[model samples]
Target: MTEPLHSGEVDRAEYDVERGKIREFARATFTTDPVHTDRNAAQAAGFTEVPATLTHTVVAGHQREQRKFVEMLGLALERVVVGSVKWTYLRPLSAGDHVVGTRRIVDDVQREGKRGGSMRVVTLETEYVDADGDPVVRLEEVLIERGEQR
Candidate 1:
């Protein structure tokens, strides 16, 4: 049997920020703040450049980056389901900032079920930081894996 993914090692991925992404998101999400849509306004507001709104963190923190763990555990991608995505913003994620996400499996547990047979509950966390090492946001995601019978 293949062992589950344990916590310790970290996976890192660099994300590039695009101006249009933030602008389009802001327009769609009804963010009235020009700081998100205009570079000049963001600079005047003391940010290095135009910054994305709160919800935009989702793009930078997607679970696709956690595939390393899924592969390590020899788990089939089809069986894994995303349980939740909780984001804690430490600071603003700006457009000009070079960002990187450091991902890790924070929690793992197994339980027996009457109907489903067995289940594994895993919690993964990805912390985003700027090139200067400033904390941007922390993304906590949960993934549930079930037994073959179910």
Candidate 2:
């Protein structure tokens, strides 16, 4: 890598949750929770509509944003591996809730390895805020690049 990426907003996106996606996620994850699939059940649980589980937010963010900072840093996706994904959720997001998110470069480091090779560890943090501008969740992830860099 030319230089270690600095902390800053690297990408952004907006997402609108749909009930079907939550239902599919609930089923795929074997949640078996009525609140995830049943709109009425979710509303009864205090959400205006079916809410996405904590896991769904990360999935939805990736799908909807369709981006990453490694790519922006001119790194290859095939060489990147997820080291960790830490989440901090402030409030549950409901279906029909429009959320805006920013993908930020929290840190990046390059280290020398054996056999005269080097690797880069890129840290990213994404924060999602609802249309109400309330913070929803913060996803802190570390992506490590392997193999040789061009």
The number of the candidate with the highest lDDT is: 2
Tell me the spans in candidate 1 whose CA falls farther than 4 Å from its real position. 1-5, 27-34, 40-48, 58-69, 114-116
- Model 2 C-alpha lDDT per residue in residues 1-150, reported as the tens digit of each score: 457557677887777877888888888899987999998888787878888877876655555434444556766778888899998989887788888878888788887767667878888888999988889989898887876856
In model 2, the clashing pairs are: none
lDDT (Cα) of model 2:
0.79
lDDT of 1: 0.77
lDDT of each: 0.77, 0.79
Best-fitting candidate, measured by TM-score?
Answer: 2
Model 2 sits at a Cα RMSD from the real structure of 3.3
